[model samples]
Target: MELITNPQPLQWPTLLKRPIFDNAEIQQRVMPILQEVAKRGDEAIRHYTQLFDKVTLNAFQVSEEEMAEAQRLVPETLQQAIAQAKRNIELFHTAQYDAEKQIETMPDVICWRKSVGIEKVGLYIPGGTAPLFSTVLMLGVPAQIAGCQEIILCTPADQYGKVNPAILFTAHLVGIQKIYKIGGAQAIAAMAYGTATIPKVHKIFGPGNQYVTAAKQLVSQTGTAIDMPAGPSEVLIIADHTANAKFVAADLLSQAEHGTDSQVILLTTHAPLANAVNAEIARQLETLPRKSIAEKALENSKIIVLPDTETAMAMSNVYAPEHLILAVEDPDALGEKVINAGSVFLGHYTPESAGDYASGTNHTLPTNGYAKAYSGVSLDSFVRKITFQHISKQGLKNIGLTISTMAEAEQLRAHAAAVYVRLEE
Candidate 1:
């Protein structure tokens, strides 16, 4: 990793000059697929599935037999782990269940708010170099907890036109029945526009590569609500001399292995520690099977040796990393200073993998600086809170004059008359 020392004051815009993709180019690439799916439905979906996935599947949706076979194919130990993770995820999401609250604003004016799950939702699970079985838990559990009526699951299939066994197993474990053998931007298009097999969803959720992210933006712009701008995975670690070099190196590599576009940065107080981490990363990179991918990602990453924790934390906020790790002397103090981060790992013991899997936190998070504004997926992702209001005659009478005067000043005669009519009636 490239190392920088004595970096000047942290200026948000000057911290890191992030590269921006060509939005026009992305839209041009995604528009036709979206239009085709919107027009031809299943026919467009199947063609793209064949062209992109290199498999001739019978149809998009996975059958009961296919799911059963996938379950049988997975190892028992993996199944047990998935089950345990499912419980943790379910417990966390179920606790997020919100109840309706009624309140009186004025004499007879009663107001209330209630949350209702979206009628339909689409989950896009990426089956790339790594099959994201955990994503099924991350997305599927919240969808189930929110009580979405129709849940559609889509994933890119392997060369043999089948999803990862673990993907199928997790889907079933979370109560999602409809699974599709599709992948990439086309699958996103299929779900957004609704093919014969894939249902049109009120909202779409999950993270993916740049292509998939572009497609999500395309569809959402036209009207569909997306969870957030989720792009490639990235991590920022703030470590000091006391931090275990091995642990810091391992955390950086964990995110690096995610994809070629994924970026990982290490910010430290001591210069020697940065060197130690780089050496440790080189050593650890040798045995990993995904070394090629991780190595490519490291090309875009950097290790900055700052002067102090305050400088490191200030720079970290500028990065707005999808995942932030504090491997400092007092990690709790570091956590308190964090203002921009999608998720956090404190101390040497809290590995990113723990939260990615069994740690009871959602793994699908905002990336590419979106951590500045977006939050990781939670129960709120699957449901929408619709505000409700009721006005008793006495209440309207109390508040109507104010409304009438305001509406009259705004020159909205109809609005003023509506209040007057109500008051008179």
Candidate 2:
């Protein structure tokens, strides 16, 4: 990791820029795949699945037999672990449910909003270098809670033409039956524009590689709703003299291992602590299985020695990391200063992995400075709030002039006439 000391605020933007691919190029490459899927349907899916995943499948949907086999293959201990995680995710998301409350603007005008689940939604789980089984709980639990009519999942099959057993097992645990053996941009296209076998969805969720991210963005333009614009996973840690070097090193490496493009940052007031954490990262990097990947990510990562906590916090807000860890002496006080972040880990004990797995928070978050605007996925992501209003004759008499006058001021005669007609009735 590069170490810089007391850089000016003018240099911060250039210093903190994420390694991002050219959007035009990515979108250019992803467009043809989407067009083919829309033009040819399941045949196109089969072709791309072979081209990208190197797996040829006769059928796209996972059968009851495959699901049963996956259940048998998953160990009891792992199944229990998944169950526990599911319960935690369910509890956290279930609490987000809001009861409808009617508000009266005037004499008899009653208005309220009700959340309705998107009837059909698709979840894309990446099964390439890592099979994110934990994501199944993060997305599936909320979709179920939101009462989505149909939930379809798409994941790539391995060279052996089989979906990951853990992925299948977790999907079954969450009551999702429509599983497809598809991957990459093809999977996004299939969900966005329905193929013969895979049904089109009202909205799509989950995270993936650059191609998958671009595919989601491309499809969204044509009217399919996507969860959010996402990129490589990232984390920013604000450490102090009281912070543990070992713990900080571990936290940084955890995100670094996500992908070669994933970046981790450390902002600290203590220069000695930065050196200690750097040494710890080098020591710990040797044992990791994804050591090569993390090493490449570290080339883009940084450890900057700032003047104080206030400067560090301001820098972090500009970066707006997907995950922010406050490894300070008084985390509670520092945490209050956080205005932008997808998810926050409050102390040394609160590692980002806890929220990624069983802590009941959704791990599907915005990346590449998007945390400044976007929020991580939650129960609300799966549902749309529809508002309804009821107005009595007396209520129309009271509010009609206000509406008509505003409509006339805006020069929308039709809108004013509509209100006048109601009042006349």
Candidate 3:
């Protein structure tokens, strides 16, 4: 990791930029896959599955038999672990479920907003070097809690024409039956545009590589709702003299191993702490199984030495990392200063992995500086709040003139006329 001593605020933008493909090139690559799936349906999906995943599949949908086999293949201990994670996820998300309450904004206007689940939603789980079974829990548990009618999942099949047993087992545990062995931009296309077998969904959720992120953005432009412009995983740590170098190094490497493009940044008040953490990272990386990938990511990562805690917090806000860890003595005090971040991990013991897995917070988060405007996926992401209002005669009489006057000022005659008619009646 590169260590910089007090970079100016203006230089931070260039330093904080995520490693990504050129916008034109990413669009160019993803558009054809989306168009082909929209045109040829399941045939296009199968073709890409073979081309990208190197696996031939007669059917894209995982059958009952495959699900049963996956259950048998998954170890009992893992199943129990998944179940425990499910309960925690369920508890956290279910609390977000709210009861509807009608309120009177005006004298006789009764208005209430009710959250209705997105009827058909699709979840894309990346199936590559590591099959993210945890993601199924993160996305699926909330979809179920939100009462989505159809929850379709798309994951790539391995070389042997098999989806990971853990993935299959998690989906089953969450009651997601419509599993499709599709991957990459093609999987996004299959969900966005209804194919022969893969049904079109109202919104798409989950994190993926650049291709998947680009596909989601492209499809969203055409009217399909997406969770967020979430892509590669990332994390930023604000550590002080009290912070543990070993823990900080482990935290940074955890996200670095996610992908070569993944970026990890460290902001510290103590100058020597940067060197200590780097030494620990070097020591830890030698033993990590994904050392090659982590090493590649570290090439883009940085350890920035700031003057103090205030500057560190300010820099963190500008960077807007997907995950922010406050490994400081007064984490709560520092966390209060956080204006932008997808998820936050407080203290040395609270690693970002806690939120990613068993801690119940959704791991499907915005990346590449999107945390400034977007939030990580939650129960609310699965549902739309539809508002209903009933106006009495007195209510119309009270507000009708105001509405008519405003409409007349805007020169919208029809809008004014509608209110006038209601008042007259």
Which residue pairs overlap in candidate 3's backbone? none
Summarize candidate 3's per-residue lDDT along 23-125 as a digit string, tens digits.
Answer: 6799999999999999998888889889988999988899999999999999999989889889999999999997999999889989999999999999999
lDDT of 1 by residue, 255-280 (tens): 99988888899999988998899999
Candidate 1, superposed: residue stretches over 4 Å from native: 9-24
Tens-place lDDT per residue, model 2, 1-425, is: 99999999999999998877887899999999999999999999999989988888999999899999999999999999999999999999999998999999788988999999999999999887789999889899999999999999999999988898999999999999999989899999999999889999989998998899999999999999999876688999999998999999999999999899899999999999989999999999999999999999999999999999889999999999999999998889988999889999998899999998998989999998889999999999999999999998888888889999999999999999998887776
Candidates 1 and 2: which is better by lDDT?
A: 2
Query: Every model's Cα RMSD, please?
Result: 1.7, 1.4, 1.5
For each candidate, give its TM-score against the true structure: 0.96, 0.97, 0.96
Ranking by TM-score: 2, 3, 1
Following a full C-alpha superposition, what root-mean-square deviation does model 3 have from the true structure?
Answer: 1.5
- For all candidates in order, the CA lDDT equals 0.87, 0.93, 0.93
Residue 377, model 2: lDDT of 96
Cα lDDT over the full model 2: 0.93
TM-score of 3: 0.96
What C-alpha lDDT, on a 0 to 100 scale, does residue 224 get in candidate 1? Answer: 87
Better of 1 and 3 by TM-score: 3
